[model samples]
Target: MADLRRVTVRAKTPSEKPTTVDHLKNLIDKVGDIDTVIGEVMSRMKLESRTESQMILSQDTEGSMEWLSTNISKINYGQHPRFSVPQRITVLLPLEALRDTPYLISVIDTKGVEGTTQRPDLMAQIEDPRTVTVLCCSFADAPGGVPLSIVRETIDAGSDAVSADRLCLLVLPRNDEALKIVNDGGDVPSDREEGYAIREGQIDQQFATDGLPGIPVNFFQVGADEPEDIWRWLTSRIEAIRTAKVERIKRHVAAADNLVTNADVAKTRQARHTIADTMAKAAERFRKLRPMVRPAHLNLIAEAKKTHQNSIAASVNRKGSWDNFPVAHILGQGVRIDANLRTRDTFVRIDEAIEGLKDDFAHLSDVAQFLENLKDDVEEARKEFLTRVALAGRNLYSPYLSQAVDMWDKCEARYGAGSGYRVDVSAIFQAQFEGDPNAMTATEKVEAQVGSIWEQIVIDPLLEAAAFEDEE
Candidate 1:
């Protein structure tokens, strides 16, 4: 299958467009026009469809004959790790949906992203609701009325091939006849209401009528007495469509196309029940733990941060004995970044364990034990690194005499504090390291400091006694 990650958003083709992308790994950041709805939709899709799947070292095994499979199914048969298809939807609006430019059937071969604004005077001349083109063409270019069959086939999909991604919006002018045609439907009667009446070549239908067998239509009167009426209608529709689309993609696309046994599907389908059952039990177990985790590493980072700050302040003041310490090199570059990596490694182990459970792992007890001990792996790694850093900190980072600092030899409450915020070290690392590391910049230092604060304060306190044992 073609990789769908890189999505393109532009004005429907044969017209001036906003953006374009053909490759899966590309992004066109600057929209040709930022003010339009298309621009908003484009930006929103890109943001929502962000994925971090990396290329795996596995190969496609489609052509090979297999009696049975090993770990190869995980590596070989499923979605190729390197070619992650991003989930996205590019809404295609009809020209009248534009509701603005091209008063007539004239082609808009505009040079750039400008001149898209609607002319109130020109627009007012004649929006004879009788004159809307089928798709993008003007009334003059072709016949006007939209076929109700299009609605039944797509939006009002009562039977097969659900267009779960579309929301049909028929925008008519104020006090226009077409508005009544769309908004009035009880005249069709009960028996006839079951299906769109075939008139000439197209099925005749109304927008407001309840299609007894399908979803009820909603109306958002633009000039409603309540100002929030329009917003309420739009927001509710957006959320409902979003939810329906998510379910459709999960059930129809993600689950249907991927390779797996029926038994595996049943397991995944029932996974929510498994989670629901274990939550209260897990909470009770956690509540019984003694002497919870503390983030002593954050304290070490904070102390290092303070030392770095003092050095900068002293240098600026031309004070006596200004300590030239490598605080950034030690804490900012070393410990903070390493903490993020440790968290990531811990997550990898967790993923492996979960994947193992997908097959109803024979060694369920062993896998459970491994999962339970995963966070400790992060703490152990942090302790070993800090020990070496402390020995080295005395010579390389002995900031002007204030208090003795022992990095590794700190109380177990610090390092043994379970995983702590280091469990989310990726965020902590990104908070500091995303941009240029201007070591001397005060803002950079503060970012690292805040990361440490979050690690120490927010994450560690959630289950404080997890890290330490009760002193009997």
Candidate 2:
């Protein structure tokens, strides 16, 4: 079942109830056990496991509303089905303002030509119900029923208020509250009115009156209907509404709308801060690697090799087999003895000491001094190793950087440079140290950019899920 939310609003038109009040009450009491009735609803709807649903009844003077919601443990299906994504399912009592309001309010621009106002809610959609009503109305079996116009007025008003694609529904119960069920099976209605009972005059009248853009609702009948039949009647409209709402968000995203925000932007950024073993986490990794990699001053492994201690054994000694992997390329890369390399944890230490001097020695002044007095090969190895690391990172991380650049380009184009999200991939990687106080080595900066892109890939989905759960 859908997760539920609650809110309170001021009451208007005291004691007046929505036209559909009795019908909803009847649906709620479909079975002797209310729990069974709710369970049936959950199964029928197949609501998203995490979607939030809120119902707003016209409030009382005490500033309270009445609603019942349930949380069902969802099975691990590939994707849960959705019904509707109404901002709020409001059962409003007052209809006077809606009845009086014109379908299209005429206005003039500063220039003086007259035209109608913008209505975003009615865009590119056909069967989405923003408002639904139940009223006593005419059908094949029942005569002398209420006019469809009465229910249309209130629901149309509701459609106008809610922005985005919308629809309205009018439900009519049989004049005889109790009657014989039809069609032998309760699932489908036959020999009686079941679904939309729209008249040609109604659609024509909607276009005639103020040239309203959308259709007036076609009514649905509740003639001796069972709960299952009603559920069938309603699900299509609800699903349509849900699809429209979800698509609206998608369309905004695809177009990179100016005001649109996404969970990915923040999630990707958070990945950088939260990850345990990042390249820039030098101090801790270096401390742990110092003992294992056997830095020059430690003299544990280097002293054991007496012959070439001046050249290859100057800083560190290799402990494990390189496994035919290139030596320079392997620096700073985590390798496993029984290598299952396809993992997020790539910082397992390469048993290389010289690479750490350029990357991690920033915090270790003693290591920097030690590097100054080293033989040419030892010092040159660190620089050559660092250059290779930077080059490989560029190859590995360019795609992530490209995507981040792309995400930001849309943002900057929409919001302008002052928005402070403009990214230039070339400039970041090409950054040089020319006396700027806040300068970073080009290699360090590349690691940062790669780190950000990594976060976006891994964290965005979790963030999006949280955001979905947070929706009201």
Candidate 3:
């Protein structure tokens, strides 16, 4: 009755899975100290054991993911708009390689930007034909070291010597003998033929037998992760010294300029004082001249008064004489009226002689006053000239005058061409009589039109003709 029936098992489809409503958040912990990671990776690569090499190579993906997760936290904390984790080296050597040979050198903590002046001293202490391998996070940091391409685009540049075939690589020892060599401050080997031997833990390797040639070397001198530290230190110190020298030169130049400026300022102040003094003297002279010139105006007024009185007196005495006449008959002689007028002419002639004498004196006084006023104006001008010379120091006056004359010439050229004749008649009418002036309502407009036509027909032609005549 218990019949065993074969049950058919079918594969489940993707749609058959149940969706969960619970929100389970996942996040990886962040890594720290990218430099420390780089150092650790480099140290692992330099391992001589095959077992360690395989282990290090296999951890590449996991290490990279961890590094990314850690770097993300740094990005969020730094709050950078654009951030990215830099590409790094993971696997150092091939997995199947029986023996792990870290073909690279690492210099530890060179702190290149400092202690440049003491580089030669430090180099003197090192032994001759020393194998120095520089290790850096990027090959660009090592200028003369062998580059190992352990990751994508990880190598930037390396030294030609290291790139050549046949490199002597050795692991530095931390044993007492190695410490003794370091402390002794003596040479390890004088030549490459007698290369040094590395005895670290159970691994002992000897280098410096020039038997193999043309094999480009990848050296691993394990120490630290610095690239060109000595060179950087020397260069930075040299730059500091050079900068100091430049600053000293600049200070000297600035001091010289200040001296020259002070001298110029002193000269300018002296010149200004001299100009003020000259102006004062000229003003005093002008004041002295002003009083001497007052007699002319007084004499002119007196003469005018006397002439009017004489004319009135003659007009009253001569009843039929033409002594007083209408202004309209000024140009023509009038007919005689009587004999009494003839006798009166003799007295008028005598009076005229006296008047002539008075006029001569009055004219001399007017001339004297004019000369005095002219002298005052000339003195004022002279004072101004002296003031300008003293204040501007005469050296710059010619250029100043030239510029002034040029500006004046431009002004004259613009305004002296009768351009003012373009009269806006409405404005003129409004200014002259306002809207209430009906008597000569169209006068301004007519005059403006006539003037424009006159200028075109007569003024322009005459000017052109004169210019042509001058040319001829």
TM-score of each predicted structure versus truth: 0.18, 0.20, 0.13
Of 1 and 2, which scores higher on TM-score?
A: 2
- Please give, for residues 145-178, the per-residue lDDT of candidate 3 as tens digits: 2212211001111112233211222223222333
The clash tally of candidate 2 reads 4
Question: Which residue pairs come into collision in candidate 1?
Answer: 291-465, 292-464, 292-465, 292-466, 293-464, 293-466, 293-467
1 against 3, candidate with superior TM-score: 1
Candidate 3 local Cα displacement, residue 152, angstroms: 27
* Residue 103 shift from truth in candidate 2, angstroms: 31
lDDT of 2 by residue, 1-472 (tens): 2332122344567886433234335656666688886776667555554354432334342322112112111212212243244433323333331223322221111111011111112111221234322222343422111223222322332222123323333335455322333322444333434323223233345445643444324444443546555544445544555676676556445435322432244433343233213323432333221112211111111111221212221211231112221112222221111011221122223213324443554333333332222222322232233334324543443333333343334323433234222122112212311222222233345445334432343233222222222222
**Ten residues in sequence with the least summed lDDT for candidate 2:** 111-120
Rank order by TM-score, top first? 2, 1, 3
Candidate 2: global Cα-lDDT? 0.31
Estimate the lDDT of model 3: 0.28
Cα RMSD (Å) per model?
A: 29.1, 32.4, 45.9
Model 3, C-alpha of 318: deviation from truth (Å): 99
**Model 1 regions more than 4 Å off:** 1-144, 147-149, 152-165, 171-173, 176-216, 224-227, 245-472
What is the lDDT of every predicted structure here? 0.32, 0.31, 0.28
